[model samples]
Target: MPALNIDFSDEELAELRETAKARGVTLKSLVREAVTEDLAQRRALAAMTAVLRAFTAEHTTAFDDAFPDDAPTGARRRGAA
Candidate 1:
């Protein structure tokens, strides 16, 4: 595996080290986990956005009909169930 070097201010590095120590993890491990989670979240959000765009384009009429502009309030629609 290759190594990557990152630069951080003294205060920032100190904070990261303190947090990592508290969590019983190395700074590298903590940073790696955070980066991995952030990337995964970004990928999932992009996929969801693409799917929503496609669905909206394909089912515009049906979607509109089901939730019309002047539909009754949710409470009224649910009734006394």
Candidate 2:
């Protein structure tokens, strides 16, 4: 693992340091844990979005058939239909 230099505002640095001390963890570990959780969350969200898009694409025809006026193809217009 490579170390990276990150600059933080004085107030933010103080808060992070205080939290690390209270939790009995190094600031580096705290930051690393946050980054790891955020990356996992992003990956999970991406996967969920892909599944939703695939499901929508697979059933778009059924949706369009059920609701022609409110179809995703912008059939709805102001004061029309």
Candidate 3:
């Protein structure tokens, strides 16, 4: 129930208004939907990043063993350096 005030260039406002009208939504509704979708995408990205980090931490040695040539010079299994 809080109000947010955002300023847009005249051209940007015109484009947003036109797009909202074409989609049969009020400008406020259009902006709200866009914000919701953006937040969802950001949350998904954060989760994906965490999963990837965990995978790398757990599998780095396995990967290095599987492809020994990919390992750093004389350094394999995470501490052969």
The most accurate candidate by lDDT is: 3
CA lDDT of each prediction against the hidden true structure: 0.83, 0.84, 0.89
Best by TM-score: 3
TM-score order of candidates, best first?
3, 2, 1
Tens digits of lDDT, candidate 2, 1-81:
788899999999999999999999999999889899999999999999999978977777788788877775553322123
lDDT of 3 by residue, 1-81 (tens): 899999999999999999999999999999999999999999999999999988987888888889888776654457543
Pairs of residues clashing in candidate 1: none
Please, what is the TM-score per model?
0.74, 0.80, 0.87
- Runs in model 3 lying further than 4 Å from the true structure: 73-81
Candidate 1 residues 4-66, lDDT tens each? 899999999999999999999999999999999999999999999999978866765565578
Off by over 4 Å in 2: 73-81
Query: Candidate 3: global Cα-lDDT?
Result: 0.89
- Least accurate 10 contiguous residues by lDDT in model 1: 72-81
Q: What's the C-alpha lDDT at position 79 in model 3?
A: 53
**Candidate 1 local Cα displacement, residue 77, angstroms:** 28
Candidate 3 lDDT at 53 equals 81
| Residue 48 displacement (Å), model 1 | 0.7
